[model samples]
Target: MSRPRRFLPSVSLLTAFEAVLRTGSTAAAARELDLTQGAVSRLVQNLESQLGQPLFLRERRRLIPTEAARAYGRDISRALDLVARASMELAANPGGGVLSLAILPAFGTRWLAPRLAGFLSAHPGITINLATRLKRFNFAAEGFDAAIHFGVDDWRGAGHLRLFDETLVACAAPAFLRANPIRQPADVHALPLLQIETRPTAWPEWFRAHGLVAPLPRGMLFDQFAPMTQAAIHGLGVALLPEFLAMPDLDEGRLQRLPGAPVSGTGSYWLVWPEARADYPPVVALRDWLAAETADLRAREGAGDGADDGDRTRTP
Candidate 1:
């Protein structure tokens, strides 16, 4: 509960301690930090004196870190990573700040990427960096300002801003569907059912919703919607795809929707960030932009924008 500076130890002291602990030698630490071995050793000594504890056991020519030193190194490593990332961001954009985001692959490419130009145009000062994340990650550890999360509002230790619910449709390449005609919902069980790895029960749940009960058909597994949709386009099998993703193909006659009605997915996409950073400027800007974007999408869908599938974005 006490501040780190209350101990009166310099950051250099802690840095030296961490480096020596990790590299297992003052000479190695010095080489890594571009400092002399003597200076590195002196920094470690200063830290030990400040803490009033023996950090290492010296055996003739060898120095072995004590348990306390190892524990301290572990704690400071994460803090050092945070400092390094922050410094890198500041250096990369000297005029302003960077909003490093973790995004779902398919949603980012198909939905967000196409709509991102508006946000960039609106916020000229902030640099937005995006990386695809297939699963939930710790924002603090991962150095992400926010994430495009697709699920219920259950991201632990985070603030959630609801984006929109996902809508799924059964579709495949027209050639595949034509070759294996589907007259009823039960017909899907016989087809090569392409499965989304994250939503293992989606096919079965869709069938159950359609009043058709059967064992889940096993088939080719895809981790993300992009490849799954591509596989379907190549006539690999029937894919349960998001309408938005399938819209371009369907409209261009590349893919065809099966007979079942559009199925509402169980989860919603959300803009999630560390609750502590709810007031961060860059995060606020992104969240506001996404709010407006999804609103426009829903409005268009409500207005019977029948040409395209209503936003079909999904997380891995």
Candidate 2:
């Protein structure tokens, strides 16, 4: 009552056909599978006979696939890939590898690096490899498991797990503010200004937040945040820095503000990873850990309740 289905070829036959289609020649397939060319050709011929369709045509001495073969090749290639991945998963362990991450130098040192040893301690089987990217970037091509970078949803080609929504602020040493009174935004122009090489518009944005004008550049620019803050600590000028990244200096009283103004971070720090890697163990774990840590930090900052407005803008 029903036509019987043709028996499917063996995994060996399917693998041989797949290898030839992918590698473009029987000799190449033989090299990949460690089989003789005649052996590989026999496998493809056997597969063709089972389906009763010619998959390749003779071109010179080599067999070339027809358009129909091209279509079949795509499906078979995908299936074989799924099977190979499953096989590897059954044979491999995820928890024992190194988690590679790219991070901004200052954020890593000032905020993240100080706290990551606890993560390493908890997962002794795992380790983290950290490298610095002074600017923002794509995590996939860099071969990083993850990355911590600045900016608002600007990076493409990945999942953006926001770590923190930072609030930027202007700060300086106590002596600088005591000597130079800063009552209004207009006063900032007369004093020395400290600029971060990354965010050239930071000061202008602060002024815009408080209804001041734009494009004010009367200070020195540094390539990194820690150095910019250091210059501020030494009272070179007022530095516009992200508040969370500057907490240590603020805590140590190395830097203080002009008074009554600290701008919330317009940008965010996000953990980025290629979607293809969404399920890797170290990546998922680090993303969760960083998210939780940032939330806790934000909660603590909120509870501080403007009590330490010392990080407000200081005079040059």
Candidate 3:
């Protein structure tokens, strides 16, 4: 399309022409628009120049409309009014836009998603669109409003408020712990180690936390926690699991914490967003809500729904 130039009529011209055609005189249109008669006449001329069609006939000190002018004016006038109404609605509420967020599938399903209705109840007008990702993402290019992401605090160009500090426990089936008899940290070396792809060195890390620096065990590593924890439940092997993520399994008697120390993982979760839009209304609201949720969980000390945590299964 050609760029708008000096010769082309602007929307001002169209407005003046339409007004004059409705009222039958440039002076009347000028009065209605709170402008000078000469200014309105100029606008009519500009409109003709752009449309390449005379919108009005020069009558005796008055403007007479062409058939096309009346039809176009009615449609454009209604459209402009509708635009004004919609713009007013949006300006009244900045928090009502679709909130696009990226999250890990398991974490979203396990934690944040379950409690999302709370946010919705307070901000019902806000729409949420969730996209799942296994790793951190580029917030700007991805068009995300915020992300509930897991990793060490390494995100660049994003404002990261740490959601939680992870406490990882080595948990296995009760039957497995009974059969394996992990009397000390090093005793984990003897068991068949079930592991996840992201943290195969968990056993080493747990051992290191207790002052033992043996090589991490070799084992079957899966990409996700659900399957890896399931392997632990079926007595496949011991898996180093996050207290937040694995606590439920331990409570259900599907897994038990071994008799050893806990390893701190790189991080747990963070409410992340681009630095530019970090203070946006929706982002700030979500950040506050998630921080509150994490704080509440920490106060419970891994005990609420996950009551049967690692502490009880320590086989003295």
TM-score computed on alpha carbons, candidate 1: 0.88
What's the lDDT for all of these models? 0.83, 0.75, 0.74
Per-residue lDDT, model 1, residue 18, is 88
Model 1 poorest ten-residue lDDT run: 307-316
lDDT (Cα, tens digit) per residue for candidate 1, span 1-97:
5687747577788788888888989999999999999999889888888888899999986789888778877878888888888899889887757
For every candidate in turn, the CA RMSD to the true structure comes to: 5.1, 10.1, 15.5
Q: How many residue pairs clash in each candidate?
A: 0, 7, 0
Between candidates 1 and 3, the lDDT winner = 1
lDDT of 2 by residue, 2-27 (tens): 66556556789889998998899999
Q: Ranking under TM-score, best-scoring first?
A: 1, 2, 3
Which pairs in model 3 have colliding backbones? none
Alpha-carbon shift of residue 77 in model 3 (angstroms): 33
Whichever of 2 and 3 has more TM-score, that candidate is 2
After the best TM-score superposition of candidate 1, give how far the Cα of residue 78 lies from its true spot, in angstroms: 2.0
Higher-TM-score candidate among 1 and 3? 1
* Cα displacement (Å) at residue 167, model 2: 0.7
